[model samples]
Target: MYNRLTLATLASLPKTITRPRYAREALRPGILHIGVGNFHRAHQAVYLNDLFNAGKSHDWALIGAGIRPADRAMRQALEAQDWLTTVVELEPGANTAQVIGSMMGFVPVGEDARAIVNALDDPNLRIVSLTVTEGGYCIDPATGSFNPEHSDIVYDASHLDAPRGVFGALVAALRRRREWGLAPFTVMSCDNIPHNGSVTRDAVAGLAALVDPELAAFVHGSVAFPNSMVDRITPITTDRERTMLTERFGIEDKRPVFCEPFRQWVIEDNFPTGRPALEDVGVTFTPHVAAFELMKLRILNGGHAAIAYPAGLLGIHFVHDAIANPLVRGFLDKLETEEIIPQVPPVPGVDLHDYYRLIASRFANPDVGDTIPRLAQDGSNRQPKFILPVTRDRLESGADVTGLALETALWCRYCAGTTDEGEPFRLDDPNAARLTPAALAAKDDPAVFLNLRDTFGDLADAPQFCSRFGIALKSLWREGTRATLQRYLNDGF
Candidate 1:
């Protein structure tokens, strides 16, 4: 019989399972991390757990905090187990489970940022990290810049004390710290956005600029926002995973995370106060992390976007299944090899083509069980960050974007709320209200979808892109996803 996973039962877990070798009682909170989602638990928390296991950085334990309502559910679940998480690494041959003890505590969840802001005000907290998804940075999707005019930014700026979003809470906390003569905490972003640290700095300092220009200046000058590239194919937790944990390891973890065996972290070494010795555990810390970050955003994340829509429209459930299909796999292979890789600049110590091969192999891991739906969600946010930049780069360099255009057309078609087989599925984007109507309209008038200025930006106005996008979208509606993919593969647009 399985026992409930808690600090009480942690020592009794199966001998085959690996867990923290250190004492949780010895851990001290030095970092307050926002958005404690599956990826954070799998990637950042895992690295810290390794660091602590090596008998170092005990004071840098993570204090998980979040501003979203979903975080409340996460807090409740983890609180039931004394803030512990069971992470299962799935390999083709065998899987393993571990109870990560990196997170020492979780902040109470609420709409207003009071609780999170209060957590940030702690003097012991030297670094305030975030995994608040790509869209959470208050960025203008079209411009790829900080949007001070965002409603959340406006709310947080005026209501500094009872801020409504992450940036507001950060502003409030930093302003208070500056007044108290305390140094501003380092703001490290683990999101997938290009130049994530700079983007985060823009959001936080930009919000501060609205309330107090002096505070904005202080935030800009004092805080360190280090760029980092984090990789792990962590799928959402389900009952299947819970059962596997119970059956295989005799542990009934409420929120067990299942991910692939591969994990990578390349961080820019810019922390002013201090950081854990993650390097000892295999994290690459360098003076320049831009090349690594760009390579990942373009190759790995961009590959996910490339395959997501076609798989979703074909009713392929699992990511590996999509990759296993000859047509889908062919589409991804051709697109990355031709259009995507050429646009990527050379990294310091990496070969772009080899990196693409590794990404494809990872995507094809059946044990990972990553769903097409998870990847296909939030295109409005993802497309801008992943696909469009490459498109813009190709267009600037006077190269044809046939594969890029097809990828975008596939996205537009996916937003139409049905598969090729007439199966209706919910459009999962936050902009569904806008996207659905536009997608439906695009079936008749392809330009209608491109008019989403916030998403397509001036790319909609580019005659070449518009022409290819129009032809690709019409072809999909006329010939269907598979045929359209096959046609693109056989002949160039």
Candidate 2:
């Protein structure tokens, strides 16, 4: 008989799925992960579990923490099953599943984050890793800087005793770390931003500076925020996945994450308080992580944003189908080759073209079940980091930004509250309320959207980009998404 997934029921799991061989009771908490999402469970947690399974890094067990109301539900689900997650690796034909036990437990998710701050204050917690998505950084979409004016940032700044956000938790904990004469933990960002480590450092330091200038100095000088490039095509869990686990795997897992079998992690080696032997796993630690970060951001992440708007407007639901569409796929290949890759510097050992090939193949894997909405979500945060940088580089180098500008225009059109098929769908973005009005206004006048100095910067005033963006926006409104995509596909704007 199938049993619900738990440490107590590990031996009862079906033979196909791999369960942890090591004892969970022996694992000591060493890392504090902020977000317990699919990507974190699939990527970071998987790597640590691999290290633990090899009978190494037993002390580096992850203590999961969250700073949101949604995290409370996640905590409830996981706590019922001993914080174990069933990760199903979806390959083309052969499938593999595993029960990950790297997380010891979830910290309380509430307004008062003293529990979280106390956990971070612990000397044993040498590393504070985050997978809180690109938007979770609380970045101002227009300026690409941390938004100190954000409500959460404002609240956390004023209330030092009981901070609510992750940055606040870190700041409060660091205040104690400095006061108690303890070394600050390494803060590693596993998010998908360009120069993610440096971006994280800016956010943390900027927040700390507002809270206390002296504490800010100590945090700025003491903490090591490592930049990292993390990749895995992990999709959100759904009722479909839960059903699959029950029918095929004979395990009643409350939370099961399904993703592509392929995974990669490239990290900058900057851990100050000491780190686990993750290099023994597949993680590549390098002094120069910028090259890898830029390559992945501009190529893989940029390509995702490139296809998402068009695919969503065209009424395509899944990512594999979107890339399989000749128009969408062609647009991605051309945009990356002609516009994006040229702006990227070469990594020491990796071929750019081979990387593109790998990314395209991964997108084409139907089993991954990555959705267009998942990719298309949070375009405000995504476009600036992933697409706009490449566009800016091309513009400065005097290269044509027709394809890139068109991509941005497609984004504007996508934000206009309806798809090309005249069907309405919810645009899940933090800035959607303001964005929709601006986008709708942009349909008549492209300058309306471009005028947002925070988002477009001086790109709107640049004659070439301004003219091309106007043309593309007009064309998308007059002709349609498909025609515009096909026009770019044929190398014409």
Question: lDDT (0-100) at residue 266 of candidate 2?
Answer: 93
The per-model lDDT (C-alpha) reads 0.92, 0.89
Best by TM-score: 1
| Local distance difference test, candidate 1 | 0.92
Q: Write the per-residue lDDT of candidate 1 for residues 1-493, one digit (tens) a residue.
A: 7879899987788898897899999999999999999999999999999999999999999999987779999999999999999999998879988889999999998878899877877888999999999889999999989998999999888899999899998889998898988878999999899999999999999999999999989988899999888999999888888888899889998888999989999999998888889899999998768888888999999999999999999999999999999999999999999999998888888888989989999999998889999999999999999999999999998999989999999999999999999999999889999999999899999999999999989998998898899999999999999899999999966
lDDT of 2 by residue, 63-117 (tens): 9998788788899999999999999999988778899999998898877788898
Clashing pairs in model 2, backbone N/Cα/C closer than 3 A: 142-454, 142-455
TM-score of each: 0.99, 0.98
Clashes of each: 0, 2
